[model samples]
Target: MKFNWMFLFTFLALTDLANAQFSSGNQFFIGANTTVSIHGLVLRPTFNNTVWSNKVLTRSPDAIVGEPTASIQQVHTFNEPTSFSGLVGLTYLTGNLNGNTEDDLQIAYFNPDEKYVTTTGSTVDKTIHFVSKNFTGFNNSFLRITATNANSVLPVTLVSFKALKEGEQAQLAWSTSDEINSDYFEVQRSAEGKIWNAIGKVQAAGDSKAERTYTFTDNSPANGQNLYRLKMVDFDGTYTHSKIVVLDFESNMMVSFYPNPLTEKLLIQADDWNEVKSVELVTKQGNVIPMNNSKAGSDPGSREYDFRKYPVGTYYIKVTRQDGGIRTQQVVKM
Candidate 1:
């Protein structure tokens, strides 16, 4: 799915306030720094999580519409099948549409009978729990939160989270606009996305209305693709996991040497010749061959050596790159 934070926020900042309670169209846009916009909806900066509801049951031309006597309804389509228990730090804010009426927001499978309800107080901030199975298929299953009346408004929102890899390290970063009774964040890692193990922990900002950024680096990330998520805990011992992100890493030492069973000379080839700083040849007995110093004298990749002077036996050719990468290959010297 395309992650357009700029588009998401820009629309959030400029949409009309009248019908802003629902999503931009019929889709629920979740994940980092994302917001939903509707015509005439004005969202306060402190109240950023918003989504426009899709069309109601009456087959209206617009994606979302309201009738004075009807209940507010909409379905949020997931880009892919999403796990119900994987959503974390989920909260919502009703737009300035419904004036003084307190509405109950309910979320569940499309069946409507099976759902969780959170009543909206005078304040617009509300939390809804998604604890069912995965929401699969193209709009077959959805994020449906029903409002008591046409004016009732609720849109789900979340904090921003990101993961990036540098060298062998994985850096995790996330930001929150507000935190309530939060305890700490446990950084979890997995070779596969299913089973997770806690690797590190970072303290949260606790209860704060101000936005805060957090970062943690995994110094010992496993080889190949590594999946990471956050286990955000509350002081009450309750916790939720952040979305999973994957980081891919490969070793830097890669090179090839020809004439393995050498009769006269040895040649080396590498992707970046400039990166190959030096080369050395040594006997299987750990004795260094002094004559191999000229192997990487000037041209590193196409470097050649006259090994005819050396007696034929098992020898190891070591290649060192400028980035501290080293690799050794064995050659039989005749």
Candidate 2:
């Protein structure tokens, strides 16, 4: 799939030539059938006489003001759907350097997953910054970019790092863009966010322009708060650590809502009704079924429901606990 040309041109910044005296200007051209890698995308440029004369632009009227505008058309294919995020830095030498000077170069990037642009640049280095937008998903994309605009090149640009609590397990999910030499990702956990131990490792893509996702379930996550991060290792043994994410795993008190495959009635029984605030019946398609409970304003654990009029099918008993916990169980109507 090709990226929308209207959207791509709108986001990219290209310097146009002004009415300035021609000093010594040099033109650079992208040779026919030339292949180049930018960010995490691999692009192959082919000649198109209608849209472009040749994939070429001259540099160094050297002033930044006289730079010519150029757009390189290329094709990028992916095996599966993907998304992208992270910094895109361009290399520039010969500058009055400082810690603050490099810091000021930070730019915002789009997050393909979140469906909205970020508010801030988030992080920055001499070669690392932020992306322009957040994309949701794509199988194959016709990627277009101003080739000369990128500088910083990292193997992996992590889009998201999140941890979800499932009972005593910590489900860790993360994604990356343009992974070039990535070897594998190590799932590390810490209780206090200080000392860390490696629990598991997931193999990396090695080289990929398409966004890639990875998951790791820490079956032995520490009780209470569990801190997690990814140790993304490269094929050459080089590695970088992702930002830390935390998950709070609280053991839920067991509850039973019974008589599965029942004829007409259903009963909900729980050991502790103090934590269970509400009980609701939801269809397989996610629509909630209204209940006519005799004790309408009473505790959820002591409730009963009549399903005689409802269709005989599968449903779910969704229970919302007082501690902001949610539990769901499958129910069947006979």
- lDDT of each residue in 135-193, candidate 1, tens digit only: 22233322332333323322111256777878778888998653656789998886534
Q: How many residue pairs clash in model 1?
A: 14
* lDDT of every model, 2 decimals: 0.50, 0.49
82-106, model 2: which lDDT tens digit per residue?
A: 2232222233232312212344332
Model 2: lDDT equals 0.49
The parts of candidate 2 lying over 4 Å away from their true place are 1-156, 250-334
Q: How many residue pairs clash in each candidate?
A: 14, 19
Taking all chains together, each candidate's TM-score versus the true structure is 0.34, 0.34
